[model samples]
Target: MMAGTPSRNELHEQNRLSWNEATKAHNSHKGDQAKFFREGGSTLFPEEIELLGDITGLSLVHLQCNAGQDTLSLARLGAIVTGVDISDEAIAFAQKLSQESGISANFDRADIFDWFEETATAGKQFDIAFSSYGAVCWISDLNLWAKGISNILKTGGRFVVVDFHPVAMIFDTDWSHKFSYYSRNRKCTQ
Candidate 1:
């Protein structure tokens, strides 16, 4: 490591701040999420629905669940759901959404790695561990993330990640090829 280089935790803190800002911007574009959920709307895609068939009665933990639309959707399907995120703003909004929608879900504001450790130390385990689109790009260490998933899951518990293909990152928003497929730059910008 080089001197004055940000450590992993420092990088995570930076990302957390970015996400706090991003969450507010992201939610602003989605109108009346609480009302949508209350009227039985879901943010889940059809593929995820099929992959997670019959989640009823399952204990599920949603990692990096920003604003928790999907987590609340899972709860509507009868799963006991807990949503965890690094951004305080996201968790706050998720809690408010859950309350307004009358959905039963637990929202925790903590880094996913720390939350996993705490949940494991408390002997808590879940039947399903889930994360979706736009979640993995913020994860600096997939190995640690995998270990955390393992720690928080019961035997035979399923871990599901639905995300964009790695090749998708090679293209810019303008649909032009811009980045190397193997780019590992610590910082990504829009």
Candidate 2:
């Protein structure tokens, strides 16, 4: 391997550790998750909710589903939901949330890439594959991500991604932007 190239196992482990660390803060005072659920507020943003219109009875897989608030929301919306996350802590928390909220769901602890293969092999394609808000940045290869989406989705399935613009990553610490936005067909690089 090249000096900076991580083996797949190493990459997965690194991300898993990072997400495990983040889970506490993400589910606690730093986030509105508790308030949202307690007050019956939606965890999903308006754009995502609009995109996921009328998911009643649809089978949906939520990729990179950290803590699974959105996944639980989808279940409450009447979709059969499966939430996949890399962090075991996140999956556990999601399962706990499902139980507390009385919303039915399946939570899987696996890397996004592996989840796709597992589902595909099990012949468990879904009507929708969804992710939102900073999830894609954790993926090392967008091509593999796209292929995974294809592998586990039915022919007419919808895939929705609601995330910050990739260009946001280009800004400096002082917020002095450097790149002029332009149209290009290119994979994002970190």
Candidate 3:
């Protein structure tokens, strides 16, 4: 390591491992997730999705679509959605949910970077690319990731992101430094 240099992957393996573990945890709790969401549905719906303007026949892509929650959410709004993640277990669970919920969509598991390359080579482009909360920082380079988004999005297509503010990222609620989890804290707020 060079003087004053840090030890971190340009693309962190820690992020990937964490996601893998999260997929496990999510599957362990999968039986309850849909029920939990139904009890307190959000204001977000197809109308909010339509506010982005016409997507009458547009294709949508959601990257890092954990367990396909919001991905199915989008499919319900009429956009044809294909969700990609690196967790096969999560993807399988999502597919099962898709079948049961009657949301027509597809899910696949692949590393995010390779996903970009393969999609491009397949001559695919999306009308909308959506990602929410925490997925961006896990990526190796924001600029490169943005470029991939550009490659994936057609002319006039849009990419949207919603995430917790940086300041909120610090300070673990469980008092654990360097590993803040949100489950218990979000529950307290609710």
Winning model by TM-score = 1
- Candidate order by lDDT, decreasing, is 1, 2, 3
Stretches of candidate 2 off by over 4 Å are 30-39, 177-190
Q: State the local distance difference test value for candidate 2.
A: 0.82
Of 2 and 3, the candidate ranking higher by TM-score: 2
- Model 3 misplaced stretches (Cα beyond 4 Å): 1-14, 30-54, 174-190
Q: 15-123, model 2: which lDDT tens digit per residue?
A: 7988898897777764545456666755788899899899999999998999988999888788999999999899998988877766789999998877778778999
Cα RMSD (Å) per model?
Answer: 1.9, 3.6, 6.9
lDDT of 1 at 165: 85
The digit string of per-residue lDDT tens for model 3 on 111-161 reads 777788899989999999888776764555567778888999999889977
The lDDT of each candidate is 0.89, 0.82, 0.70
Q: Is 1 or 2 the stronger prediction by TM-score?
A: 1
Q: Where in model 1 is the C-alpha error above 4 Å?
A: 188-190
What does the lDDT read for residue 70 in candidate 1? 92
